[model samples]
Target: MTKRSPFLELDGVTVDFPIYSGGSRSLKKTLVSIGTGGRIKRGGGRISIQALKDVSIRLGHGDRLGLVGHNGAGKTTLLRTMSGVYEPTIGRVRASGRMATIFDFTLGLDFDATGYENITLQGMLLGLTRSGVAGLVDEIAAFTDLGGYLDMPIRTYSAGMLTRLAFAVATSTDPELLLMDEWIETGDADFFQRAEARLKTLIERAGILVLASHNLALIRHYCTSAAWLEHGQLKAIGPVEEVLAAAGLSVANAALAGRQSFSNAQ
Candidate 1:
């Protein structure tokens, strides 16, 4: 009995974002100048930044991939590309699983809406129907443990409360492909305990997890494989230890400190 191949594939994938001068950032100006298809040009004074360049990756079931790199290293861009938020400028990206991205917990949340209402709104943003989210209201509410605060507007909620509600709603459904920017480590000690448990459960249930984190120890402990991105390119992809070593990290020390393995790059 042999195993199946990966459901996700990226080949020569390139994503570009045009750099508009401050004056040309207005909607009217942007609309009139929507011509460049992700390439550099001189006459237009519009330059495109290649956030990802000829990058390739393959992810299979049970693959926990750790994305390692610096702040502008295209890790998040690659994750967004995989999540279908950004279309490739030069190549192709294909996947065959239900994907959920937790890039920013507060991204689609409504500050003026009550916690309960925002849950429905966020759920809808995840491609669920209003009725679909309504059905899970109790479960999500229970997970947040906000009690009466659920009726209050999100603007009234504290940072920890916001995080709790956001996390609960984000993980309400089980997604086959889970893409996370980093480990959730905010909130108080008690909340932290609960969040840790919930995160562990969610990760276990996910068939594939792509975690982009600066914490190398988490990567070494959780991910069987790693992908290192540097300046909008795939630097290395292989076993965790090997990739860390290639990035000039003292793997043993990094594992103990829970710090980033790419100290040189940082």
Candidate 2:
């Protein structure tokens, strides 16, 4: 059978998060019309925040999309929604093919488990069968360079070691649709170089990629198109350069502008 091409679509999606005040009289005054990203709605004695409002996007095989926005702009929320972590309250998400998400490297890790055991655990959580995980064990182990430490419980591992282990396992499988929140950085220079190379290979192999990041240069390098989101609404979507220009970001000033936007949002 010929393999089907990967695709992802969100139609008229709107995500709302209900806020429970627990009958606290002060809660209503404190949260109403406050904060960024979403609008607060109060009706029928209920309060809710609309994280995404009427958002629609469709991506097919070979489409590399970059999401750009300031903090609380719903970029991460959108990525999570695309990964099926959050179902739209008022719309639909349709996707085809095996999907992989890099939102949290240590998502399924257990600190008390030995490195080798955690490998099996995390692999299974990533949708791999037990036998399939067994096949990739040696490769993932070697990539981490943990050696005999693989026999030790992960709680004893340093932060860098944990990062190496999680990253190695997360990238073990080839995915047709990949979603990432941002570029991952490792501690040591040597490991960072190796991880970057491996990450490039993984991105190249994916049929579709949706990456949410504040780094314009990184997005320009990896994505063919871009979407600018503001306050949970998509402001613009088109070619990377055009969208970046529309957002008043240029390669020369993107880094500084990104920093300013982040700070201002906070």
Candidate 3:
């Protein structure tokens, strides 16, 4: 049987951001950096960051794939590219669904707007219509329970309040594909418990999920399959158990070995 094409494809994607040493010269420095290494060394920086390089993946209808990598190993970059936040410089991407993403450094809130207003703005940005956003506004505000605070500007709210409101809105949106950089774990410990329960339900409702997380237990328990990312490419892609073992993260063998060693010592 032939396998279907993934809903999202990152075909040998590569992206880079330029680095410059001097900031004051502006357009004048452009000429200097192009002509000579000496000028560039003096005015432009010697190094640059390659955020993503020749990375590729395919996410399908049934894929609950976990992305594993060290920090700066392109995990977040891959998620951002897939989410349309960062376009690939050297590759083609084909996407075929409405997406909901949560990697918000600050939950992408606007300070000038009320929690109620910001939810509508962000929801529309996520592809919802006026009524679609309106219908959810009440639900979001009620769930967050900011109460009269919902009428106040977001700037006046606490960080935890902002996160709660942001998460409430983002989670309430029903998207075909869900992209999570890190699972939502914000606010006080009490709020965290509620967020986790919501997360479990949200994961079940989505058609496909591409998660990048350092929490292995959550990855293993939730993902139907797994992909191990190292550097800028996939190291292993298969059934959750097999790929995890190939990544040297399986705990069964380690536990058995420890038991044997302990017995021998006794």
Candidate 4:
């Protein structure tokens, strides 16, 4: 029997963002640095940030991978790289199957457009055809329950209303590979339960799920494997418990230690 190909593969993938340290504001200066592989030197009046450095991972079908790290540890950067929003400055990323990402739910929405119109706009931005988006409008509108507000310009909606509209449109479609920065929880208690159920269903339906989150319990519950990142490098990758333990976040071990301490005191 032959082995299956990876649904997602990253080998030595690095991402760089230019830092203009009081240098020329000209496009030419920035363009010149794009191909330099994020190199920085003293007195250059320019700097480059290696947001991800030589990060590698592989995920086949049915894999739920969690990413754990401190802030500015390249967790979000890696997710953006996987979603094709950020191209790797060096090395490569190969992803098979259709990919859908739920990061920044309000991104790409037109404030001037009506809620219904923005549904078509956001859906198209997600790689759906016009007809494809049209088909989803009713489903999204029903899920959002915006009713008359759906015909009003998005700018007129309150912040919570806008969030509802965005979440509805985002989760309306399914994809082969799903990427999320963090678990999305919204609304009051009544609505949060509904959102939680929808989120659970979405995760269950995806072929592959890569989630970057700070919630250790949530990660352990949903992810089959995990990776720890620090300073733009992968510190560890393996079973969820092993990776979490290596990252000094052993929840189970800590609980056990707490019990032992209490017993000794008794």
Q: Who wins the TM-score comparison?
A: 2
* Model 3 ranges off by over 4 Å: 1-6, 23-25, 32-48, 105-107, 250-266
Per residue, candidate 1 scores C-alpha lDDT tens digits across 10-47 of 99999989887664678765555565444344765667
Task: Write one digit per residue (lDDT tens) for candidate 4, span 1-266.
Answer: 56444399899999988775643466766667666645465655556898999999998889999998877899999999997778998989989787888888888989999998999999988889999999899888887878999999999998778888898878878877899887765656765777778788888888899998777777888999999999999999999999998999776555654443344322
On residues 1-266, what C-alpha lDDT tens digit does candidate 3 reach at each position?
56444388878898775665575347666665565534534424445567777877777777788876555667888888888878887897778776778777354578999878888888876678989998888788778878999889999998789888888877887666788876666759888888887887888877788887666776787898888777767788878888878878668644553443344222
TM-score of 4: 0.84
Return the lDDT, model 1, position 220: 81
Best by lDDT: 2
CA lDDT, every model vs. true structure? 0.84, 0.88, 0.75, 0.84
The sequence of per-residue lDDT tens digits that candidate 2 reaches over residues 15-79 is 88778775434655447535442444447456778888889999999999999887788998899
User: In model 2, what lDDT does residue 3 have?
Assistant: 83
> lDDT of candidate 3 vs native?
0.75
Q: What clash count does candidate 4 reach?
A: 0
Q: Whole-model lDDT for model 1 versus the true structure?
A: 0.84
* Model 3 lDDT, residue 36, Cα: 55
Q: What's the lDDT of the predicted structure labeled candidate 2?
A: 0.88
Where does candidate 1 have its weakest 10-residue lDDT segment?
A: 257-266
Q: Under the 3 Å rule for N, CA and C atoms, how many clashes does model 2 have?
A: 0
